[model samples]
Target: MSPTIFYGQTGKFTFRMLATVLGGQSICILLGALVARAIAATDQGSGSSTAYLVVGVGLGALCIVAAGLMRRPWGVTLGWVVQALTLLSALVVPMMFVVGLFFLALWVTCLVKGAKVDAEMARREAAAGGSEAGADDDGTADRVDG
Candidate 1:
């Protein structure tokens, strides 16, 4: 519930997000290539599908940027946007089910990990302050007794 639990330590979370984005992008690229190949084989004119694949890759790249900017509002927003788009793709193309599932899982992982990372950072900060306060009080206590 605390904000710190969502915005504190972000190193691991950021890394995971980056990995997820990269992985997602790769999947998109691969799928797009396959679609293009299929279209070519059937002479189905897959230009549009190829375009979609390019868009997916672009979105993935944006997500990567977002992961890096996790500390910024833009990063989170862009990441969510990419996630939404990935999910939406499923509605139009059932073939994208596998990619959709993977992206969804990755998104959830980022959310949970992001929160945990922040909580950990906050805890560390608090502990550091507590130690500093304890040390400061130690000298005062001895001085008062003397």
Candidate 2:
């Protein structure tokens, strides 16, 4: 059986970019749980601390897992989903609207810019080595050994 390759080796600018944003989001989600609990203290209608922690940890886990899944094709899709959920989090924490928007913009910018950088790096590598990496069906790069 052929071994599955990992695309991360060929291009990691986007990976690092997304990981930073997602890691920060995960931490924020966890912290938001405390905020939610505090907010609920003053407002009975805001929900319970247990529920907040559960939801917060769940969302935070999603972010962390999404970061780990960056080598897969669907990882980017999952990242987008995380972004949407983060934005939707404003429903629970009003301040999250601004935070979510900021992270969303950062995510988009990072993705776009990171891809360009990776491509440029790949071009440079190919020009220097006179060989190009071929992508596998699973979205990983097949490094050609000269």
Residues 22-67, model 2: lDDT tens digits: 9998988888867876777787765576787788789999999988
| Residue 7 lDDT, candidate 2, scale 0-100 | 30
Which ten-residue region of model 1 has the weakest summed lDDT? Answer: 2-11
Displacement of the residue 139 alpha carbon in candidate 2, Å: 30
Q: Per-residue alpha-carbon lDDT of model 1 for 1-146, expressed as tens digits? A: 53222233345555466456645655574565456445545555444665655665665566566656666645555656666766666554555667766776766676677667756988897987776754554534223554
Displacement of residue 90 (Cα, Å) in model 2 is 0.5
Measured by TM-score, the strongest candidate is: 2
Worst 10 residues of 2 by lDDT: 1-10
Q: With candidate 1 superimposed using the best TM-score fit, by how many Å does residue 7's alpha carbon deviate from the native? A: 11
Stretches off by above 4 angstroms in model 2 are 1-10, 45-47, 131-146
